[model samples]
Every structure is written in structure tokens, then in C-alpha cells.
Target: MAGLAVGAVVVLALLVLLRRRYVVARVWGHSMSPTFHDGERVVATRRRHYRVGDVIVFRPRSRTTDVAWRIKRIAAVAGDPVPAWLETDHPVVPAGRVVVVGDNTGHSEDSRQLGYIDLAAVAGAVPHRAAPEGS
Candidate 1:
């Protein structure tokens, strides 16, 4: 019983640390193709803010899907206005919004397709790709 208690405590500590540090997500769709493939797993850090060029996942505001977990490069941050082609009426990204774009424009459906994502929608920033076994 004593050993069990200690083991439980250790496991809880690890879970807390891991949750505060990183999150793992499986890649879906081809929005970020060539950079992150479908079915691949990626590790993202739960950091405060991401810099330009950082790959991130956030929710999309489109009718096709309620929640879109897309990997896109941070093009601009809050207070910055997105390009004209992306949208026409949406104001500059708010103080808590992030402008993300796909690395591959040809196939990616991102800010260009929808709009800026609120910082609250950001799940995390990808730190590294986890390759599947035998590949």
C-alpha cells in the first residue's frame, strides 16, 4: 500500500509537468503537407506566444468544420492587420488573435480560407515531428 501511494504520487507529478510543458497531437488533413504528413504525431509546447514562422494549431471559423486543428506558420500577431486578400471586413487581429498561414499555399486552407484565429483557439506550437515506426 505504501509503495502504491508513492507510485501514484510520482505519476501525478509527471502528468502535471508534461501537461504544463507539451501536448501531443496526431496530424490530420493535408493543409500542412510536405511539412507534416497525415497520421503523423507531433509534439507541441504550451508556450505563451509564438514568433513569426512558428508552426501552430488553432481552431478555424468555417462552416465546413466546427473545429479545425490546422498547422500553420505564424504570419502575424495581435494588433497586426492581415493582408487584403485574406479578408475584407475583419479588423486587424485583436490583442489576443494570431494570423497563421500554411507553408504550402497551394493546398492549405488557412487564414486565407477563413480568418485570423483567436489566441484562445491556439492549442499549442509544434516543437518536433514524431515519425511512425518503420518509417
Candidate 2:
């Protein structure tokens, strides 16, 4: 009985902490190459808003899957004019949206391929990285 009560408390604490803090995700592609490599685990803080140059994870708009998470760099912010490539009258990054793209243009599928992601879709921003082996 004591163990069960302690377990329940621990679970509740985790739920509350996760709701207010960050999450961890393992990078799976080369989209953020050089900065974040495949197989790397990244720590994402959910409290802060994304800014230019910050690496963020967000779900893309897609038909086949309910969620499509990707890690990319924040290229623009709300109220900014749309880039020449994006054909939309709305600001590229509206008040609740973020414009993200991969550093490796050659192989990344990002905002350049899909479109801006809602701020709610942003899981968090990458904060720390583990050192590479032998480094």
C-alpha cells in the first residue's frame, strides 16, 4: 500500500512537471545536420518562445499522419512578410505560427516543402546536445 501511494505521487509529479517544462526527443534525420545529427537525443524546453536561429521541433501538416514532427531552425517570426517562394498573403509567421527550415537544404523537408507551423504544434526548442564520441 505504501509503495502504491508513492508510485501514484511520482506519476502525478511527472505529469505536472511535464506540463510545465520540457521533453526529450531523439533526432532521426539529417535535416538539422552539422547542428543536430541523426541518432542524437535533444532536450527541448517548452517554456520559451522560439527565435531566429533557434532549433525547434514541430509537427507538419500532412494527410497520411496525424503528427509529423521535425527539427529545424526558426527562420522568421510573426508579422514578417512572406518569402518570395511562399505564395500566401498571410504573414509567413503569424502571431501563433513559426517558420522553420532545415539547415541541410539538400535533403530536408521543411517549411520550404510544406508551410508554416502553428505555435501550438511546436513541442519545444533544443537546448543542449551530448558530446560526440571520443570528443
Candidate 3:
């Protein structure tokens, strides 16, 4: 009986933490494939400071469609150096925004296509998978 009570408390605490720190999202394309497959579920923490190469979930400001969210890796963060390889004439990442891209470049619509992502829209880094759990 004591073990059951302890298990319930642990589960409840985890749920509360998750509820406060993360928001659930679902991936739906090959844009981030190989890393995140189509129809894969994702959880991103609440908006916080992020660095380059971090995967984030955000809403694109340049998009006019009803699409809700997008998940991609941050290529550049506010005021960070933009590599010469990016092929952009404007080299530095703008303030309060980030340049994002997908693992699957060929199929992704990222900073390469649209403009930088607003920091205000960023949800936060996607949590790392602890194990090879199935989708």
C-alpha cells in the first residue's frame, strides 16, 4: 500500500513539472525527418534563452497560413555569427530572432526560405530522448 502511494506521488509530481515546463506538439512532415519523423509527438519547454544548434518549436512570423507550429534547429541566435557558408549577404543574425533550419534541408522551409524566427514565438529546446523509445 505504501509503495502504491509513493508511485502515485511520483507520477503526479512528474505530471505537474511537465505541465509547467513543456507544451505538446506533433510533427507532420519530412522537414525534420530522420531526426523527427512525420506524425511524431514532441514536447518543448516554455520560452527561454536558447543557443545555436538547439532544436526549437516556434511559429513563423512570415507565414500567412494557418499552420500552428514548426520544429527546427537554430542555425544562429540573436547577434551570433553567421557562417560564410550560409550564402547570405546579411551575415549576422538579427536581434531578438533566430535562423532555423531542418535536418532534411532538401525538404525543409527554414530561414533559408523564410526570414528569421521571432524569439517571442520560440517555445524552447526539444527534450532529448532518454532511450530508443518507439513513436
Better of 2 and 3 by TM-score: 2
Instruction: Give the alpha carbon lDDT tens digit for every residue of 4-31 in model 3.
Output: 9999999999999887788787886888
Per residue, candidate 2 scores C-alpha lDDT tens digits across 1-135 of 999999999999999888667767777778777778898877788845667777887766674443346788777778777666666767545788777767776777777777887888788888744322331
| Number of the candidate with higher TM-score, 1 or 3 | 1
Clashing pairs in 2: none
TM-score comparison, 1 vs 2, better candidate: 1
lDDT of 1 at 84: 64
Worst-scoring 10-residue span by lDDT in model 1: 126-135
Clashing pairs in 1: none
Error of 2 at 13 (Å): 1.7
For residues 2-96, could you state the per-residue lDDT of candidate 1 as single tens digits?
A: 99999999999999999778767777776677778888888778778777667887666654863346677787887777666676576676678
Give candidate 1 regions above 4 Å deviation. Answer: 61-68, 128-135
Q: Which regions of candidate 2 deviate over 4 angstroms? A: 1-4, 63-68, 128-135
True-structure lDDT of candidate 3 = 0.78
Quick one: ranking by TM-score, best first? 1, 2, 3
TM-score of 1: 0.78
Per-candidate TM vs. native? Answer: 0.78, 0.77, 0.73
Error of 1 at 121 (Å): 1.7
